[model samples]
Target chain A: MTLVMAGAISHAPGITGREKMAPEDKKTRYYDACYRFRDHLWDQKPDALVLVSAEHFGNFFMDKMPTFCIGLADDYQGPIETEEFLNIPKTTIPGAPELARRIADVAMQEVDLGYSQEWSFDHGFMVPLAFLTPKWDLPIIPLNINCQVPPLAPLQRCHALGKALRKAIDAQPERIALIGCGGISHWPATPDSGKINEEWDRAFLEDFVANKTDRLLRYSNDEIYRDAGPGGQEVRTFITVAGAVEGHGGELWCYEAIPIFAVGCTVVNMDVAA
Target chain B: MSVYYLDKLMYQLNRDPMVQARYKEDREALLEEYRLTDEERQAVLDEDIGKLYSLGNQPQLLMHFAALVGYAWMDYIEAMRVGAEKYGEPQYQR
Candidate 1:
């Protein structure tokens, strides 16, 4: 039972230098919550982290996109683009290739998972890492879900893949923390792109904290697109995390509707060790 | 006019530094490689938010493309608003 803790969080680049654009109160609330989440991760003191996030055209393009891919590289680098705007220090983080390879192997054996030995993480992985572990010392296993492109894996499939991931994690010797990053609601480039659906975002967070994922898991991509915007598809990462922690409930650390970033940022920690 | 090509072009522009440099240096020649229609080509060249929106480019990609073309944050948002009005609401908005 080496799965020590698991959590989900939003990865808006705005979370980095929010004070530049956000109001004072909003900035304070967001940063305070971020520090709280960071503190929680430190409390866990896991030897390795399994980061689940989406690729923002930084690694895979439309030419060739995998539904689910695990990175098996010994090191990963990012904030791949938009470094200046994100204000994240440029550095490469060490990776857990041994664990990554095991996860890939388990997925292949259990669910026939797709994988890559070469993939550079984008903001989806880096932004959250910047806040959660600024030290950049934790060895990570970066897993990606194809949320940007259409014909994405259904919510059920994401859950199933997560279950497979859980099995892989259970086999590991090190204390592992699983962190799922992305989304409550946001429209990145559409006409109504910058709007955040606060009501929807809050409800989703409520359900997540309550561990009432039955409703959340049932949502179709079209329903999520209509309600939370296309970027809401990134919620699939959360769903995958929830799937990995099936039968467990978690605490909601924070939820904020930050329009400046056009995302409803949220943080939750599952009761993994219980 | 496949909306897919619009996405494809944006993907290439974002992922390939050479393509981005060429887009910045010689916009027309770089666009020639893609099978974009006249309107699409013009939209990319002009950095027309409305035309690109109407052409059905993905919002995320379109946003990054605008940034690469040197539009400031607010300016890019304004461009999308103007484009939506001029070209009709994007399907996502509807």
Candidate 2:
């Protein structure tokens, strides 16, 4: 049976420093929770990690944009100029066409979306990569979404897709893990951008950990984007992350609101029953 | 595709007066809308291809550009191997 693990931290310049763009110490200062959860991942050491994230700059350009671009590459790299373009590992993750095709088919059967067999990872996927998996040896199958632009995937659609991913993983023969990156109320423009929605945050956490997914998927894209910020839109990735967990109920891995640049540097661990 | 590359298209258009007319309008609009820092605004008006690419926004177009050039250059060779079997050989010879 394949094991899929997933999580996301919204883009808080604090996570990626504000003034100098100094990379945050994800291991300690930035994602303390991820570190704790990292132990569990280290233990599992799945042969491959399938990453799903939105493209801040890997598969977008002026004029035309794609809603979803899957990285079917031997590796990925961020633009050279940005500091977030740190040395993240390049992955040759197996893109089980049969599996990806099945997930896409299941999703399209339910939602209005497009599909592609090829794509690459961007800063949203890479910065975390620098901190999350830096070895550069592991293989990663990336799913890049069009979160920045509107007419994008709704929170419900992402949740449904995550559900589909779990179904796909179950069919796979190899052990697999998943990570969905992005979120926890943070703005990119203003210095005072990262707003901590503890009330909603806690409620979601409760619903997540209690396996009470009924309320979890009920939240709408408008509610989340309005509350989070246009950039906070990436929060839909969490729906997929939530869907990846075999069972519900998330343990508070760690939470921090580094307002210096407006991002909630929070991380949570979803315990999967062994 | 990166806007850096699109701006390159704009840069190539600087030689065309008509395209330059619209370019200036969209250029100013981009500055105001993106709330581009003075530095960003200045870089565009100054026509700095390198700085534009650095911002790294709307990168999907780069793929389009690569494809355009790829087809122009590689289509011939690729057509021989892949396309020939599918659409027959291209009659137009460079």
TM-score for chain A, candidates 1 onward in order: 0.95, 0.78
Per-prediction DockQ scores?
Answer: 0.46, 0.04
TM-score of each: 0.94, 0.65
Interface RMSD of each: 3.9, 20.1
* Docking model 2 quality class: incorrect
Docking class of 1: acceptable
Tens-digit per-residue lDDT, A1-274, candidate 2: 4655555544332354342343455325555565565566666776666677776544453246666555444445542213422233344324444545544554555444455554454456655555565565556667766776567776666777777777666667666677777765554432123456666666665665565556777766677665665556676677677766747566666665555435666666665443
Q: In model 2 chain B, which range of ten residues has the least summed lDDT?
A: B57-66
Model 1, span B31-88: residue lDDT tens: 8888888888888888887678767787768878888878877787788888877887
Give the residue spans of candidate 1 off by over 4 A: B91-94
Strongest candidate by DockQ: 1
